[model samples]
Target: MKRFVLLVLLVALGGGGYYAYRQQHSAGQEARASAVAQPRAVPVEVANVELMTVAEEVEALGTLAADEMVVIAPEIAGRVIELGFKEGESVKKGQELVKLDTAILSAELKQAQADLGLARDTHERLRSLVSRGSGTQVSLDEAIAKLASSEARVELAKAKLAQSTIVAPFNGVVGLRSVGVGDFVAVGKPLITLTNIDPIKIDFRVPEIFLSRLKVGQPVSMRVDAVPDRTFTGQTYAIDPVVDINGRAIRLRAAIPNADLTLKPGLFARLAITVDQRLNAIVIPEMAVVPDGMGKMVYVVDGGKAKRIPVELGKRLPGKVEVLSGLTPKMQIITAGQMRLRDGSAIAIKDKPLRTSQL
Candidate 1:
């Protein structure tokens, strides 16, 4: 009776375990089947690529420099007697910038003038005496020598006086003052830096590949990060004859008009130089094109599926880019759903494109 009871208990426990396992397995299979039947949520959008002409431009970082930068220095040693211009002052050509002590020079000039007058009188007298044969030839010759010596002294004195006053060489803005009133200055000492700021220069370089397309007098647009919201317009002024051996780039310079003095010297700038103008080029939104490992590609929606098509990219513009090849005038492209798409993946166009109003 004990054995019989044990056997019955064992059978009951085994049967109950088997039934639970079967129920759990059946529930898992149903859940998996339901999940498989449900559709995946995919976000999608559409774009149309149209052929339009786009201008090609090259970009580079550059610096704004003065057209002419000169360091003003004293030519002769003297004590500063007067400060004609202050720091950061604009001066015109030949304007007096600083006055050095000229008291000694002035006295020397007065002496020279007196000597010159005396010599002139003596020379006149000698000439008259020589013509009349009242004076010896030797005496007349001595008088002539004295007159020439006096004239030379006068010239030397005038040169000295001129050197005492420092003048501006050209029209420009002066930098900080290096010497003050009563300060002694030496020859070759820098007084200040003078810079011609009107119509400044922007120096930039372009890749050698653009050598054929680039030309002198091409229009360039410049922007400086130092001053926000301001763009300086300019044109290509010059191009180097030879390419840079190290960088393999061609140096180019542009002249920018700084009428309001908004652009300053030594400020960093970014330049956009239009090298070529395409009359009729295919343009599409930059985001519409996707970059694959091999090359740049874009998906064209045809027969409700994404068709992976490779493209040749050209000049890039703000928010839009130009396609050199692999597109037509009117073709629907997948723009927004690229992240979730692969080759030949099915796509559903969500909403119609927003129409742009023509002016």
Candidate 2:
């Protein structure tokens, strides 16, 4: 009875061991086959980078300057007696600006008038005497000379009196006053400054390459740093005939209308001039390009691989760039995931298409 029980237990143990070993072997084979059948996940993306040819544009930065600026100065020296206008006041041409003390000039004018009256009487007497042969020719001639000299002195005194007052030469805005009442100023000293704001001039510079594009009356759009939202329109008034040899640039002057006096001289501004226009050109997002040390290039995707292609770049606009060469409209390019890729790298396509806004 004991031997029978031991034999049954042995049989059961052997059967259990065989069953466990077969199960383990089957699982191993199944795992190997599954590993071979399943595809590896290669985190990747797809981009349809197209080739394009775009227009060429040039950009430049410049400053704004006055079209006409001048300083007010006294031609004759005298004490300032009256200020005709306040500082920063707008004055018209020939408007009175300053008045000088003319007390000495007034007295001199009075003395000349008395002298002229006496000379006139003497001249009349001499003429009558000469006609009657009672006066010598030499005496009549002396009297005539004295009368002419006295009249000249009277005119000279009146001219001096007129010089005592200063007037504006043109219509402009007056600047600060350098002198006040009772201040003595010398000749050629600056009394004030004035600037013509109407039809203001804006001066800027452009590269010499745009020399041919610049015309005498080309329109220009300008914006001031102080007033970004406001854009002033003007036309090119003049171009410097000579180019700056040191900077390789051409100076440009444009006339801007500042009727409201909003634009002031010496205020910095940004200027833009459109050289040319294009009807249709190849344009791409800026991210599609990868700049190399020597040149620029982009990765073209084909047959689940990345192919590096070099390209010639042209004008770069906001968010879009112009491709001069090495691309076509139908070609696909890798815009995203470029950093993780290299030349001839295997790639997998993503489900979603790339959008222009994505870049």
Ten-residue region with minimum lDDT total, candidate 1: 350-359
RMSD of 2: 9.5
Our model 1 lands, by Cα RMSD against the true structure, at 13.2
Q: Tell me the TM-score of model 2.
A: 0.59
C-alpha RMSD by candidate, in order: 13.2, 9.5
Determine which window of 10 residues in candidate 2 has minimal summed lDDT.
49-58
**Angstrom error at residue 190, model 1:** 1.7
Write model 2 residue lDDT over 183-244, tens digit each, in one string.
99998899898788898887788999889888887767788888888988888878999999
Poorly placed runs, candidate 1 (over 4 Å): 1-53, 134-141, 279-314, 318-359
TM-scores, each model vs. reference: 0.66, 0.59
Candidate 2 regions off by >4 Å? Answer: 1-58, 275-359
TM-score of 1: 0.66
Candidate 1 Cα deviation (angstroms), residue 250: 1.8
